[model samples]
Target: MTGTAGDVIRIAKSQVGYHEGYSGGHWTNLQKYSPAVPGLEWSQNQAWCATFAAWCFQEAGMPKGSYPVTASCALGVSWWENAGRFSDYPGIGAQVFFGSGGGSHTGLVYAYDADFIYTAEGNTNSSGSAEGDGVYLKKRARRDTYVYGYGYPSYPTGIVTADPAWKNPTAPSQQEEAVALTDDDIKKIGRQVVTGANGAKSPDDPTVEWAMSSFLGLTYKTARTIAADVAAVKAKVESLSVGGVDLDALAEKVADKLAARLAE
Candidate 1:
């Protein structure tokens, strides 16, 4: 599995109960971290569902070609429409838009069923109105008139979970590494590895081979060969320069770290 869908949903699920504070202080802080929306004098009272969506995509390490980060729902819609990714079918990590004629609110789709679509929305609450207190995970009918389609982001394959909601965090390791890798190192390694797999270049991406050696703490050719052997056991990597190398697990290993890096 490419794991991109799982990665995006995991990040969004991490922020389920987040709410905006008085005068929108909380939402403003979310906006501050998003580089895409700038210069405008942002007020706590301003609409921020779009801001949250953009920030989540940014945090997911999704490239603009796959996901556009923007504050205006209309603008966000335009971006997906331009990319030809807008569609009626809601898939994991697809941006579910609401309203009609133009658009109103937007959110990241978490889970869905024939009758309803589960969502993680910002500037909304239990009442499910666009103008609300903060971020929430809500359920809306699939046939709800407010539904305006979606922005479908491409994913690698395996990350999507059967569970309908985000799971709790995993326990931290009590045993530390001999040399602990910094967040930056993890993120860099992840980006290099993912881009190597998912980038336009495909199997030619060097980091696939490079990361395995690094993860094994090996710097020699033999180590990479062994790594390729281990990877090849998992998936078909029969062609290209690294004839026997595989990347399915490599991408999953780096997904969470790469996601954290995007948040940074």
Candidate 2:
């Protein structure tokens, strides 16, 4: 599986303040995305908005050579279109492209509504121009000039199982990291349980995929396909609804069952 949209957004959000400058730090960092151009020089003149987007995909675990590392917004759009993922409206995490100086500019879609869209863009600033000075979040109306179509990356929707070759025995389960489950988390997990019980399959449902992978140690595919696994998930959901079962105990039981299934 490829990186999640969550992974892309998290990585992009980490670089919000990056700026083009004489110091060359941002330039050198973005250069890592384009290793094929050996000994590339750092330059403020170089347009890096697209490179920044590609780098986020890379850092989010997009396989090398699967995505093109280009500085051209048009090229990025071309790739997504060729893959049949281009669309007129922007989706969350879609790559928003714009025309600039006979070329193009781009950013990641953060959110949108009927009137406007918000973005996390690099090499831009408060004014939101494509050729602005640094990385900054910007908002624009939907009908803004130069608003080219979006390039949607094919983010994985299933629980991304670790490769057996790369799985780390020491990694902690998602429940271990939470310490305490919030009402929202429990409700969300319960929804996933109901979905599985009903035998629903949504390759684009990130929340359930996350819960299945992180809390239950099951992939979306595995949880939905295996009857016993679905029954276990449904039982937990019923326990949550009835309000007497110990969540911690149920979590452990589900995890153990899921881990056994994974072994099969």
TM-scores for the candidates: 0.53, 0.52
Clashes of each: 3, 0
Query: Model 2 reaches what TM-score against the true structure?
Result: 0.52
> Candidate 2's error at 132, in angstroms?
1.7
lDDT, candidate 1, 158-194, per-residue tens = 2233234423235444564356899879866666665
Give the per-residue lDDT digits (tens) of candidate 2, residues 1-264.
257777887888888877655454343323333443322234225777887888777778876655546777777878877876666676777788887521478888777887788888887778887777677888888777778777666655522221123221354657788798899888776766756864667534665666555655545556677777668698767869677768778778878987787789
The lowest-lDDT stretch of 10 consecutive residues in candidate 2 is 159-168
Give the winner by TM-score: 1
Task: Extract clashing residue pairs from model 2.
Answer: none
Q: Candidate 2: list runs displaced more than 4 Å.
A: 23-45, 100-102, 158-264
Query: What would you estimate as the lDDT of candidate 2?
Result: 0.69
